[model samples]
Target: MKNYDVVIVGACTAGTYFAHLLAKEGLKVLVIDKDSEQNLCKRLDIFHFTRDSYDQFDIPVSGDGDAEWVHDFDLCLSKSALDNHPKKSHTKVAVMHLPLFIKRLRERAISAGVEFHFEESFVDVVYNDQKQVCGITTTKGYYDARLVVDASGIPSVVRRKIEDDYIESFEITPRDKFYVLLKYVQLNNPDDKVELSTSWPYYKGWIAPQHNKSGAIIGVGANISYDYAYKCMDKFEKAIKLPEYTLQYEEKGCTPYCRPPLSFVTDGFMVIGDAACLTKPWNGEGIPSAWVQCTPAAKVVAKALSDGKIATKEDLWDINVLYQRGEGAEYAGTRAMLIGAVNMSAKDNDYLFANDIVFCDDDKGPNPNVVGTLLKGVFSGKFSLGGLISLMSASNKGEKLKKHYQKYPESPAGYHKWAKTALKLWKKVGTMADTVKDA
Candidate 1:
């Protein structure tokens, strides 16, 4: 039996970051993944994260920026890479290839003295007599350790195998958010920048410019029912016309966004990333938040083992409290902005668009190009929607929206109650809209 200080499953962003950090601290760490895919989990797309301060958008961004972290980077060998790359005139955010990023992280871990055990699937976990985590059982063999960190992205076998009694409070309702992304040929007009267009009836669509000037277009339909999502996936391809180009890759996935079970940690084990239900409520971004969570998690896990303290839910909650505080403030701000926009007049919308262009040019951040961020901010209640309208209509709609956004209860009890009521409102509005259409 092999034993170590810690064992982490899944070598993606969170796993990689944790392994690197723990290894640097001189803790023996072992990382396992199902495969050493050259380009396996790569999204074949470009991605950007908004500032840590903005949490309203679903893609997770950590408000905690104090953690020391590193990325594995390598220069692409292709000379035409720059020429073929997609234009981010819309937002000067960096393009990311997931596979490449993962590979780099793997190399970084190796350099930091973390051991890699690829192509290994975790079959079970070994618990000490006291019900503390002792290690893990893999298809290859059983490895013993003081702690186990489950970073297995979406489906966590360890989490699943643990008795339901081990589970803490979990969101009972299951939510499946689906999305489809495609790679299309680059347009002849090099001057044209990629744009994300929003639709009122369906989900909004995003187009990311990639290397070779090709575009990766994706559409997510979360509000629609699961059955509706399947329809949207098929319909989306037709809805977004693809230019003649060789298809490089296609990714389809459904995420469960409901709160995860409270028992994320047992006496001897812990879970992180998607497996731990760290996804945001409004949008489905988990990577950035996972990165943020991993830092504190790694630190705490190390401390617990070194200090002879058993890890518990309270420790996890301590981290969650900090994350929620920073992320919560941003969510509150976004809600304030969005409420203002929903109340805006048509004329004000136009003014907001123009002003967005100016902000797009000035702000140096990962926020969506100005217009999209402004619109998102309005919808999220972060920015002043009425202020945007004021540039044209001089209405106080922004103030009204601010008041409503402020009404969001800040306490845990208050938020839960508010969320429940809001869901009811959504259900009511959906029913009314359907009835009106039928009439």
Candidate 2:
């Protein structure tokens, strides 16, 4: 069997990005993808990753990402703040051509002497006698690796194959997906900016200016089926008076709109990116969180190997601990807080939004649960004690989940007890979006 220091089962952003990081550190890396080279990153979205993040990762920026920095985000509400509604502005947001960005990453990885295998789907996980992951068998063939990483998006093929005796698998249900449609169109609006507006648990739409500036890419994100979301786009097009723009191209897909697992590490294996459910809480953006989550993973894996040690569960446990204390913790709390908001009665939601109490900012912006700002906004605009209490209650639940996440066990020694407690707490913190629609 061919061997390498690492075998990444999915060569998407998380897998390839992390593979490049490792290879740059002088590690032997192998990245495999089921899709062909030309069609990589085929699913396109009108998404923007942060400028700060690009510099943080040291990934070179080319094309429109190199254009003038723009942060003009206009958020409209379905309801009004008196006879009006509250609006939230965003910060530190920018756009990039995703397929090109990924291609650059892939090429950079290849330059670092990393091996690439495309059009080969993962078949199964190979294991050693001690029940540790030793390698993986792909549709193309079999290869051995010291560590196996599952970056195969939400399906998480390698994670699904885990016998359940190891780490508890995190699965995405139907309720955890957002059926989305994005289209590039020739616009008539002279304004060269993007905007997103929606009502909770129902309809959301956005418009992002294309790099060429000839037109823009507008999209609809919905909690319904692909067909329903497809139809919803027509409504969004009508909502904005989309000016009979010609459709240049379009993409319809789904994103996992769920919180990541409390822990996703085990002996000789790691699961990351969408497979770990690291999308941002507000807009369900996956790119930034994928990079954020995987950066720490690369560092942890690098350190684990630096000592000439195999990445056992204990060695990799820090990945969970650090993320829980950082991005994972914030994401879990934000998710609960958001689900709490969406599950509110429409009247309550209308009151909150009309008062600018929640969902006032772009989803890609900072924290979703902005307790102090929300408290002030409620105090000044609505001045209703019930509103104040509702905001506080959501804040409290978010804090509780964050605390639980901070207490993630140092090793497998206390994982069961910790995981049990975390699950019990999460059971109290989901949404009723399954029943919501544009009302």
Candidate 3:
């Protein structure tokens, strides 16, 4: 049997990036994917990445002439339900083709000595006498490895097959995912061409510049399915005035929109990226957020496997501590707060926007008297009492969750007790899907 230092399933962005990072540390890495290399990451044709993220992760920037590069924009605006009040933020963003971007990432991994096997699907995991994952069996053959990582996106192929107390194998159901539909369109008038991104958060829709100078991509995301996403798009078009455009094509995909597993590591195994539900709460973007976990994990995993030492849960526990107490904590609070923030009526949403409450330009930090303002809105009949209560309750729960995450156990010794409290808090926070009526 062939032996490797690490075996990673799913050779998409997460798997390939992690593989490259590990291989650079002198670890033997093997990455396998069910799809052919040519077909990788083709589900979405266009996506956006912030310019700063490239430098943060030390990835090569896609320039104007690059095959992956589509265009660049600096301004992003979010409008109220009535489309009256617009809140703007500035950040340089690069538009790129997904498959081409993945290709570039894959090339980097190859250059770093990471082995890749295309069209090889994971069948199951091989366990040692201690019930630790020692290797994985694929459709073609078996390969032994000291560490096994699951980066298998939403299906979580390898993670779902493992039966362990540390790893949660619950399927990401329709309710736990965001079904996104994108419509590629060409504007009828050159003057109406889009150069920046504009979002209507009330409808969960946005329009952003595409590769074509006179074209743009209109997208909407909702719980349940694409059919529901289409309904959201309809509601958005009716409420907001958009430039006239003809649809050229459409694409659809899903992203996890729920809290991630409390523990991402176990005996000789770890999970990252979409397999671990590491997506941003506000945007449902997984790449940069998953990289947040991957960065620290690579360091911890490299050290755990050094000098031929077996990586146990205790050895790998630092990955959880570093992540859970940092971005993980921030995301947990934001995710919880958003559920209540968006569960208000359209009139209430417009009131908040008009009053510079929630969707205001936050470059100067939040308003100091947010509580007083919310109370004023409630009394003025602009917002419902129930909505106000829900928002306050959710915000409180979010704070508690964030503080709890900050106290994340340094080792696995106190994890169960910490997780027990976290579960109860999350149960009360509920999910964004809960706010969707009839979904």
Candidate 4:
């Protein structure tokens, strides 16, 4: 019957960040995870944190000239780079060795008096008579807290505990793509420095290096159904021609993108990171949105607690409203855009290459990097029209007609709204497929 101010389930990247932030504010925090401590610490994949973020968190970039966390895409994009790029281009990003990075955050939280519990799984969620989440029942014991933060990832325990209506508060759901990644492969040129290379295919993941002279080769893709992805995965290994020098330390699973609940707080409880589905809906990039969105979530939670207002699902709805106003809205919009592109044509891989509209190369030369190409396209506003048409066509004819009906608005709002509505409608179409049994 021990009680804490806050109990955080799942100590992964976003969970680590949330705990550290909450603990720093003098909240009594306990972080629990099902994974072994060593396994959690050994996660070495490149998790990105946006630039300007280090200043927010008070963590300095690594001073080691070689340990640079922030890299200027402009400096290294290609021999040929574009003159103008999308606003997303100038945004500097920090890519970290997630395990070590998380360890540092955890250490800081611990120093600030946060408790850590490992190898414990949260088996059930506790609810009071009001149907508000009170705490969690874990393998170790039933721990009560004034607030519970479920960062347990997509298959969320706290979310499951709530009624289905409560679960669907944000009106979002999962898509059919999952990412199977190969981690920690040493290349033949172990001595060589790691550079960004999108040429390695399968929707182009990433090449992340470790201090131990080893690196990881990652790949990602969308538009492929989940069942087909297993076969596609076999082909991915073959496509990459995974080097013999590449030692497979770990293979990991991730949702290709998560359509997170718009708001994650409910009566006396809140969720963060994957538990809330704070993942990107298109590229599976959860780290940026997680960090960007956490500050607001924390603010609301802290405010509710200090104001002596019992957090309620209605309050959670308000919090979701707050989130949707910021990066959350942009993420939703971006997802709609990408899904529209995907539905345009299965063969359309416009994001993978530079098009004629935005063909400007870097002053130096054509840097075969994908960012270079992507930036060029973004600046030119040369999105895949074919993709747009294809996506709309795939939706029910009724949905398409609804969009057309809205097309007469003076501005572009109608288009965006129509696209969002159509995306939801299309998702409903796929749900029927989910009911079909596997042979």
Per lDDT, the best of the predicted structures is 3
Task: Give the deviation of candidate 1 from the true structure as CA RMSD.
Answer: 10.3
lDDT of 4 by residue, 248-334 (tens): 575556553545553465577777776676766545667656766676666656655665445665544545555655555555544
What global local distance difference test value does model 4 have?
Answer: 0.55
- RMSD to the true structure for each prediction, in A, is 10.3, 4.6, 1.0, 8.1
lDDT of 3 at 58: 90
Candidate 4 TM-score, true structure as reference: 0.70
Q: What are the lDDT scores of the predictions, listed in order?
A: 0.51, 0.71, 0.90, 0.55
- Spell out the clash pairs found in candidate 2: 80-84, 80-85, 81-84, 81-85, 88-360, 267-313
lDDT of 3 by residue, 332-386 (tens): 9999988988898888788778777767785855667778888998898888888
Better of 1 and 3 by TM-score: 3
- Report model 3's TM-score to 2 decimal places: 0.98
Lowest-scoring 10 consecutive residues by lDDT in candidate 4?
Answer: 78-87
Error of 1 at 162 (Å): 2.7
Candidate 2 positional error at 192, Å = 7.8
Tens-place lDDT per residue, model 2, 1-439, is 7978889988878888999988877788999999998888777634576656768887775443443333333333343212235344444456565666687789889999989898999999888888888889988899888789999987888988886444657567657777777787776566533344333232366656665465777777766477777777766555444445678888777788766766788877888888888888777778778787677778788877776556888888888888888888888888777765655444455566643455454553344455565566556663445555655676688889998887778887888888788888777675434434652
In angstroms, the error of model 1 at 95 is 0.5
TM-score of 2: 0.83
Stretches > 4 Å off in candidate 4: 41-46, 57-60, 63-95, 169-177, 183-194, 199-218, 222-250, 307-309, 314-318, 343-388, 391-439
